[model samples]
Target: MSTWNRTGPVVVEVDGSAEYLRIVDYASAEALRCGAELVLVAPYSAHASVSPMMPGYSPKAPAERADDALRAAVAHVRHRDGYATELAAVAGEGSRVRVLAHAARKARMLVVGRSRSRGPQRLMHAHTNLTLASRAGCPVVVVPASWKPCLMDRKVAVGIDGTALSAEALEFAFGTAAGREGDLTVVHAGLPAEHAWNDEDPDHSWISRADHLLSETLAPWTGRFPNVRVTRFLSSRQPAAALVHESSEVGLVVVGSHTGALPVDPVARRSVAAMTCPVAIVPHHVTATDHERISAAPRRPARRAGRSDVLTP
Candidate 1:
């Protein structure tokens, strides 16, 4: 039997870095507010730092350090929040990323700090955040150090353009919303007005059909998630621009890596580069078995474009 709960459990992943703790604090507070349980993974390991002299030591040191540090972090969290959190050192691993992916099986959402804290003038590292979101199984929430968790409708957002790959994204998003007890927004963008009803054009029907398809695609999920509010919006701008624009108000945005027979939107792929929030590129084949949640996940295959982005308070 799988340890994974079909109901929903929000998982917050951390290295317990100062930056990550801030994120955990923010997310935990939100979870508490939403009446959701927080599962904290304080890996006893640390990623091996770059050192030619200690190449082999890099892999093992992080596990031990992460385990110890995570326990301390959990203790602090318990004292501050009035209850102890479920903490895991994440037993075995091929790598930190790989371990987390496996643990994600039982989680509705995976939370990770986008990057370490930086000076006021510093910017976030797109590569790190992208890798975490792209590879994670569940919808990955990239919490920033400066992020202020507020009680708003701006919960998780999933982008779907009527593709099977989108079904994967929606399934993950719906499960995450249920876990968080948060609202969800479905955003779709079509061509400019000229292409909206130009039935003569080869792809005109593609744009025209979005409204109905968007409604149908989400129909089954609505009844299953009455408490998790859903909103559908259509834009006449380019897919990437509109999606990125919608992300400005969302805590996270979920998009299909590639949907059905169509390749993932290049702009949406790149739109993540400039998105105001974290974007999880949900893959089509993510699944896990029993008890412990998988921590690291398979890396998102190389995308055609490589722009990524993040922000802070």
Candidate 2:
């Protein structure tokens, strides 16, 4: 069970890599905008069976080293941003996916950096991003290492499948667009007609049905976010390809991952890896009971502007 409460901090994984630093910058800016604390987590795992007969086989040394690295990385980022009070650091011992996934249970969102490799190389080592996106308690945002902050056309793109998962993604996309005062583009990809039909052809009923479905899916959200400029893109291509192409022009792409559909759908996996900008994977259903518990918990006071704190796990 995972809570989808907004009271939790935004968690970002930091490994002191160049890609991780870029992630830090993006995550920091996002945290400030959302008025949420930024948590940097560094996860490490030690090799098993270090024989005492060998020189200096201390079991606690690996954990201490990981903690030191995490502390340094956090301090560096905090100093660079001059946002000491808005940040916290945590050091955990385990595999990266396991540790970060655990942290995400109490986070508003989890942010991570993607590798520069593309095509086959990228696919070969995309398990980390896929796992986090599919299994995290909250939404997971994956940003490319080469992405930098700059002036650009601001728009949020969401893929709509007319499913409950897609509805949740629509809510997130609409809220994000409203918060940023950006444009919202809802894309629905439908299969092509088996035979060409003219405008007046009576056999074009399927096309009309697809159009109606798109409209019905977006009707409520358009009213909810009246201020957000909305654009509808109905494409004949596959959903993954259409969204991947749309990702090039938007600041963020929002996609839905069913609760148990991971490593099973090749299209979903490919879309996440192909996106040029940050990709946000929103789950269909988070635990309602967990949300209640989190909402009922006591709230902590805001930290003073100059204070800095580090948490260990």
Candidate 3:
């Protein structure tokens, strides 16, 4: 039998980097907050990349390197102010996404480190994150390698359109904010071209419409999490840019992505690349196991149904 639980441990990727302690730190804090176990995963190939052109390429066997990485992460967690949230480390042999997805089959959430690589390298890295998020069957958090503990760590923001796509993301954002005892910022960015201006009202009308949309979307969550303060922001800026801007002031930016066949929207792709803080990519759909868990949770109150000026970018 698999160790997969509907509300399982928080699984994080351990990439064998000397700086990966930061990733471990963030994940461990999240695990502690949710009272979930923290499982560190390191994926490596058994075969070493040996080449005749460069015989010096052999550093160490991939398995050995993975073991070393897991050991270091375990030690880091153990030494962190006497951190004691149930922890486990696994070294799996396979591709990155495959191993991590399997490890987090039905986990509470999956966390991974984001690469700062630019140009083509950055695109490739983003694709991997997207795939992982889709396959993990749980929320996936991509934390920047440069992330450090800061005052903004408690601040969380999420992007939403007037569609079901953002429903799951909203839930994650509100839950996270509640856990941190922090405020939640809800951003709705609309393109000027998408709306028609009238002589009766121009800028103010669009702003009002956006505000109304956010109010409707957030009604259920606000009632459920009465303690979480919310800030509604409406802007004419591009969706991706708007999210990236908010990321500078927030610890986490949550965005919804389509699961299965559909690719993540362009806004999510761009935000992940430019965000200054960690980004949580929540899929719109959930696995059967997750449905079982959610079915038992408190049901959210229904909201007034109607579409507004929220663009589905």
For model 1, the run of ten residues with the poorest summed lDDT: 304-313
Q: Is candidate 1 or candidate 3 better by lDDT?
A: 3
Taken over the whole model, the C-alpha lDDT of each candidate is 0.59, 0.71, 0.80
lDDT of 2 at 148: 84
TM-score per prediction, in order, is 0.66, 0.79, 0.85
Model 1 residue 99 CA deviation in Å: 2.9
* lDDT by residue for model 2 (1-313), tens: 1123445888988875655687887888778778889888888777645786877855556667667767776776667777643778888888888889898887878988887887887764454565675576577888888878864436899887664446667887887888788999888774564532456774555556656777887888888789999988877766778888998899898877645442323556677778889988776663465356536857655431111000000
- Model 1's alpha-carbon lDDT is 0.59
**lDDT tens per residue, model 1, 24-120:** 7765764665466676665333446677887665444656766665676676677778664443434443565666666666665667665443432
Ranking by TM-score: 3, 2, 1
lDDT per residue as tens, model 3, 1-313: 1222237899999988877789989999999988999999999987787778987676788999999999999998899836668999999999988999999887989999888799778767876787788888788999988889888989999988866667778888888999999999998885475663555776566666777777888888898899999998777777878888899899999987767765455557767777789998877674576456646856544431111112243
Residue 60 Cα positional deviation in candidate 3, in Å, after optimal superposition: 3.1
As for TM-score, the candidate ahead, 2 or 3, is 3
Off by over 4 Å in 1: 1-11, 26-39, 42-64, 91-94, 116-136, 175-183, 199-207, 227-229, 258-268, 278-281, 286-313
**What's the lDDT of the predicted structure labeled candidate 3?**
0.80
- Which pairs clash inside model 2? none
